[model samples]
Structures are given as structure tokens and as C-alpha cells.
Target chain A: MPFSISLTVNGVSRNVELDDPRVTLLDLLRERLDLPGTKKGCDRGQCGACTVLVDGRRVNSCLALALSHDGAEITTIEGVAQGDELHPVQAAFIAHDAFQCGFCTPGQIMSAIGLINEGQAGDDPERIREAMSGNLCRCAAYVGIVDAVIEAQKRLADAGRREAA
Target chain B: MKTFDYVRPATIAEAVAASAAPGAAYLASGTNLLDLMKVGAARPDRLIDITHIAGLDHIDWLADGGVRIGALVRNADLAHDPAFVRAYPAVAEALLSGASAQLRNAATGGGNLLQRTRCAYFGDPASACNKREPGSGCDALGGENRLHAVLGWSPSCIAVHPSDFCVPLVALDAVAEIEGRAGRREIPLESLYCLPGDAPQRETVLEPGDLIVALRLADPTAFARHARYLKLRERTSYAFAVVSAAAALAMEEGRIRQARLALGGVAAKPWRARAAEDILAGARPGETIFRRAAEAALADARPSGDNAYKIELARRIIVRALTLAAAGTPQRLPALPASPFSSAPGARHAA
Candidate 1:
């Protein structure tokens, strides 16, 4: 049965008609919404390349059924940057050379943002590395990824303190 | 993935009724179900989404110092719950050691309890697997049997339950609550999983249309306080355990009063080492006694050719876990190794 559902994607309302219920959130984001920034690496949840923020929690969109998350507030990589300014995590990824092929950069950035939001990514490099293990880098840029996450966490914290002050 | 009719029920009774329909399955987080569906292992004609059902998403503290975790409680929230962490650190540790952060955020309590094995042969439709297709011969019997079971396996199937949470739950003596058409009933968590006897297809004791309501832990005691979960995997993190142990001990004046031990990656289900527990009951907390207990635990272990190393590994991990539990030291995460992708010719180094 085809059902019409509405979702809040990247702070905007997205209403779509689903002919098939098995269409995954990753497919919907890429095909229906035309947001191809969230790459689908393995389609299974193991790769973490389809990671997106659903209700402020990081989840692999490839495993998520589109109909199951009808009203969820989803934030993909395409929404992370402003009109001109990139998110601190994205900026840090560039500064730290966190990618080789750039296919997994969006997912790595989203996962890093989730880590910072969960307050798990402290200044410690080991903690950051463990927390970011979900996002794999096939090009072995893990060193730069870890450094970027740690730096981004510090920068986010500093910004938070400034806003509070 | 095949196109299936999806229905989200707002009530438990409706969900149960929907589950009773022919070729119907209840979907929660879809961490495992979606993957299995994609691989054609599970082809349900109808999916009943139960994530919207209310009142099944809480972690309640019982009056008797026990904890009642709802069926819909996500693995990540359950692991990070302060009450669960403070009381049963081993449970939290076991959950953390199992899957990645993204998976833990989506996997629910009931889903984890009912998650299937990760046998490569079983996932492949063309391969001969009794679990995937009953009455078929087990291809893993002689083929690439490194990850096969070392204990509690029948000739039909040697696949082990790939869950880290079940190890600690069995050690803690937890109970599973189920709701069926008749009424609600409870059973020991260990009884929920069945041994892979002649009928390897029957994984759990859950009856048709029965929905797992919650998991309840009894009163927290000394065993809960002195507990440790040690998992050894192929890699430092984000990998399934090669062999793991969840050990808890209650001591009195340097003597063992009560002990609980469960082994993972060794059997069809979480293998509870009751014989080893008996050996450590009255013994002193020392290396010799721990070694004896570990030996007693593996006395009945029957390993395949390629996985014979698991016996020695399990023995060492059991002893190490018991020693750490006796000393009240929490297990530390192992350091990460350099990525295997780093050695590839096209891999780029960090600037």
C-alpha cells in the first residue's frame, strides 16, 4: 500500500508518496529528496557511510525504513553547512586532511558531530578514536580523522562557552 | 529488499494480533532485521512496526533493587543508564563491547535478545546451512570453520549466538517477560535460547505470536558489584568477539562465596559455566583456583579443527576475567591497532 508521509529534513518539511515500504531512508534521502551527500557504502549498517542524525541521534540511514520514521527530524550532511560557513567539524576535517577520496567525509563529519553532541568526544585522542570507530575510512585516514574530531570538539566547546558568556 | 506491506500498531494487542498473521514479523529498530531481509534470509510478507507503541521504552527501577528494562529500550540508552551502570557494570560493559555506536542507538532490548547468528554460510543462500534451510547439510562443518562454535553444537549447525549482552544477562540470572494471547509469563533468560540439538532451526523458545515484553533483573547483590566483562575479538574495537567471558564473584574473607560465569562465542547460546561456578564456590580467590575453574569450564568443550585455538583463548580469558572480578577492577578498553587499510599501496597517510 502506498502511503503519504511527512518528515522534517534539514529543518524543512518533506512530504513524499512511497510506492514501496521497503525503501530505506538512505534511498529516500538520495532518490526522493535529491540529497546525495549521504553516500551509501555497504547498504548494511557496518560501513557507517549512510550515517545521519535522526532526532539528534546518529543512526545508519541505510538500515532504517523510510515509513518507520515518518515524523522524525533528520539532519544529513547537506544540512551541516550554512550558506557560507561550514560546520566546525567539516572545517576541522579539511584542516586535518581527514579524507583521501572524500567519499566518506560526510558520514565521518556527521558521526563526529554526533560524538560532540553526546559529549563523548573529549579532548583525549583515544576517546575520540573509540567514539568514531563506527565511521570507517578505507583510505586509512584514521589518524587525521581522530585529530579532526578532537579539534572540532574543543572548538565546539569553546564556542559553547562563548555563547554562554 | 522485497516490497512488504508495513503497518505500525499503536497498541500491544494490535501488534500481537498482527504478528499472528501468516508471514508477518514485528519490526523495531531494524538493525538486524533489515540486514537479514536485504540478504534474503528473512522474507516476511508483512512487517508490523512496533516502534510507535507507547509504554515500552522505559528503564524502571523495581522496589527490590532490581531493574525492569522495557522491550523497546535502545541498547545505547540502556548501556548508558546511570542506574544500570552503577549496579550492573558488567551488563553495560557487555553491551558496549558488542556493536558500533550507531547500531547501539537503534537496536532495542528485545531485538538484541532475538538477534540471529552471523555465520557467513548461513547468510549466503546458496550455501548449505541447516539454520537457513533446515534438513540441508552444514557446509561450515568442514569449510572455513574458524568462527564455528567450540561448545554446545550439534552436527546440524555449529553457529554461535553473536550477542555480547546475552553473556552478562545469563551470568546475572535475568528473567525474560513475554506476552502471549493467553497472558503474560516469565522465564529465565537462559531458558529463552535453546541449544542447537537435532533441530537447529529452532533458535529460541518463543512461541508464535508471543511478544517479548521486558527483561527483569533480580535484586542486585555482591555478584553484581564484583563483576567484569572481558571480550577478545579479531580487532581492538567494532568487531565480534573471538571469545568472551562475563564473570562475577561474591567473596567473603578472601574466599569465594558465590560465582557466576558465562562464555560467548563458544556455543549456540550464551554458555553458562555452571560446573566452573561449583568449583569456585568454596575455593580461595587465587590463580590456582581460577585456573582449575577455567579448566572445569572447558572440560566439555568440543572444538572443530580450525577453531581449536578458541579453547586455550577461552581458558586464558576466563581466568583473566575471574581475577579482575575478584580485584574489583573494571576492564579497560584495549588500544586501537593501526588500520589494516594503511598498508595498501593507494592508502594515503595523514597530513
Candidate 2:
């Protein structure tokens, strides 16, 4: 018999079947929930196509089992923005042309936002590059990825300053 | 991946109970195991997920000034620990140089130590890899063995250890605290990995019911202060190592008091360079000492095909690491300014 699990994903209470707790959260999202924004690349974790925010901390969804995350809040690419306004990361990515094929874009954006929120983002290019090491794009579009992150930080700071002014 | 029974135990005892079962494997972060399962390399009949066991993910101060890190502690947490950065920089640096942010956030201390080799032949489903199938003949012996072992290999298998963390732990003389059906005991990190003499099927000495619970690091030493880990990967990051070295040096008035060395990407297990250590002890730090130490370490090196580059590459990595360790410490900035293009990910030279 499959076990029943209760989870809060994208701020909604949900019930699911978990016969095999070894099924990665990525599998649950893409296979069961039909949220295909999380791509599966190198299913072995060599690539970061399946990044997601678990309780606001970015993790590789393909490596984390859905069962172990009971009661934890999860936010995917689907939950990043309001209905009309895109999140700053998404907007910056679009502005800077951060992606080519758009397969690994969601993961890269999620990771960058998580880093900025975690206070791991810094002005140094190396730390930014080092922290962004997990996400790989086949088109080798790292230059644009870094540019998008820097631009997002600047935009957020500018918005904060304007609101205070 | 084969369908298997799974349990997420809320308590350590329950997790251990599940892990004690025959054919049951304890799942930490599951970064490595899950990946292997997807490729049809590892299949466990039962997986006992221990990520929810809260207390097992702590880093406590030992009464003896050392640190006891829980097996389930995430790699990112350990890498950024202030005490680890101050005491054993090599270990902190090793953890930082591996995988990437998201993967390390999900990779556990136990899982990092037990990660499998990246021998291309071993991972390919069609190839004859003795590690995957015993007595199935190792095609890597006469095949495209660009990542095969240069040390601690036999006629059977030549797969290199792929971890960036275990290399430094071996040099530090760290120990593992494990609990299982047989109860709790500590083993040296050096003896944890087994060299493939003939039976390449076996990777570690871990029994069927053993579960790694903690890793205990020893007190800081002069050698630890001068330690460094340098990795040369295909694209500088994310990719596995083409050649890497974890080395520690002790110096007095330009004379080497003691030096410890270990090689990765060139060995079946993290190769402990006792010969190089002995040769460089109390020796001067210069081209002569570096050349001889490299020669002694690679004296028995056996490379195949395009991997011959690793012979020189591994030597250069060792020399560069040792040179930096002996040459000079980085100037302290007003604040911690992260390096932009460091040769190694975690070589923060300081007091």
C-alpha cells in the first residue's frame, strides 16, 4: 500500500501518494504534479536542470526525495512570480538574454535568487561564478547568466532606494 | 531505477533500525546514490532515508578541541563553517572545490566520502566494468581509459576515486563513527576505502548493515595550517577532475619539517603518498625537492591511453599546491574579499 503524505507546495496544502519514498521531488513535480518546468538532465546530478526552492533554500530536486520533505514548503519555477508581474530574476534574465535554449534557465534563475536571498551573492565575480557553478547550459551562456544576476541585484537595490526616497 | 521499499524515519534509532536490515542502504542527501540508481549502477532492495533525523546533522565541539560532524550534515554547511575554515582549511577547501552550490547543498558528509569512481567504462551500461559486474572483465584495461587509476590498481580494475573531499580527509587522519547491527565503532578514514587487488566489485569495507553516523576530525596541526587541495577539471568547475592533489607542508627556515601528500584522479582510492612524505620531510623547498617528491609519488604510476597527461598533471598539481603552501600566505584584506579566479576553489592561505 502506498503511504499518504501532506505537503505545502507553492503555498497550497496537498495530498499525494508515496509508495516509493525514493522518488525524487523532481519526479513528483514533473511526473505526478505535471509541473514540467523542472527538466531532467544527467539525472545523476551532474547538471542543475531541476533546481527548486525548498523552504527558500535552493536544492537539486532530482536528488531530494519528496518523502523526506514532509511539512516543508516548496516553490518551483511555477511559483516564482505573481500572476501578472514576473520576479526580478525572471525579468533580469529576459533583459540580459541570460538563456539560449531556455532549458536550464529556470534552474539558473532559481539558484541566483536563492543565493541573493541567502546573502551569498557578492560583488566579486569569482564568488558569483563559484556559487553558480552547479547550473550548466549546453550553449555555454554563462556570461549572460552572470550579467542577469548582477542586473537583478542592481534593479532590486534601485527599487528599494526609490521606495525609501 | 528499480522499485524498492522506502522509509523516512523521524528518529535516529528508527533510522538505524531500518538501516540495520539486510540489503538496506541508509540514504543521506541521496545526491550520489539516486544518480547511480537512475543509470542502473546501484540497486538497493530497501532505502532507509535518514535526512529527517534532526540531531544527526550537527557539528559539535568535542571536549578535546577537535570537531565531530554528523554524517548527515550537508557539505555546504561544513564548507562554510568558521571553525573549519580556521582549523582545518584543507578540509573546508576540499568541500568547497567539489560539485557546485546546489549539489553540495544536497550532498552529505557520509555520501561525499562514499561516492563512486567516475571511470567512464564503469558508468557505461554496455562496457564490461568489473566494479559493476564481477568477473565481467574490465574493458578499461585496454579501452579508452582516460580516467583509470595510476596508483593502487591491479589487473582487474583501474578506476580512480572521483571525490574532491576524501583526498584531504585521508591526509588528515580523520575517523568515521558508525553504528549498525554490530553497534558503534570508529575506523580511520584511510582504511575506509579498499584498494581493488583482484575483486573490483567491492568498493569499501562497509558491511551490509553498517551505517556511517559521524566523522571525527583530529586536533589542528602545523601541517593542517599549510594544507591545500588543487583540482584540475575539464572546464574548471562542475566537471570531474582530470588531476588533483591534497597536500600539507610544515616548514622552518626554508626546511621542510614534515609534509603529507595524497593524490586524486590518479588512483583507485585517494593515494596516500608515504614515499613522497618521507622524501620531503626535513628537505629544502625548491625545484629539487619538488621534483624528487613528485618522482617518488609517481614511481609506481601506471597510466593508460590519453590519461598519460595525468602523470605530469598530477605532479604539477602536487608541486603547485606544495609551493603555495610553502611560498607565502595571501595578504589579509580589510574584509574577506573572495578570490575571483583562484587556481583552486578553497586555497585561502592565512594564519
A1-165, model 1: which lDDT tens digit per residue?
Answer: 688889999999989999889889999999999999999999999889999999999999999999999899999999989988999999999999999999888999999998889885478786677778888989989999988888898899999999999
**Candidate 2 lDDT over residue span B227-306, tens digit each:** 77777776766767777777788778778898888887787787788899999999988767877898888988867555
Runs of candidate 2 with Cα error greater than 4 angstroms are A19-22, A156-165, B304-306, B328-351
**Residues forming the 10-long window of minimal summed lDDT in candidate 1 chain A:** A120-129
DockQ of each: 0.68, 0.58
lDDT of 1 by residue, B294-314 (tens): 999999887864899999889
Off by over 4 Å in 1: B331-351
Which ten contiguous residues of candidate 2 chain B have the minimum total lDDT?
A: B331-340
Q: Report the poorest 10 consecutive residues by lDDT, candidate 1 chain B.
A: B337-346
Chain B TM-score of all predictions, in order? Answer: 0.93, 0.91
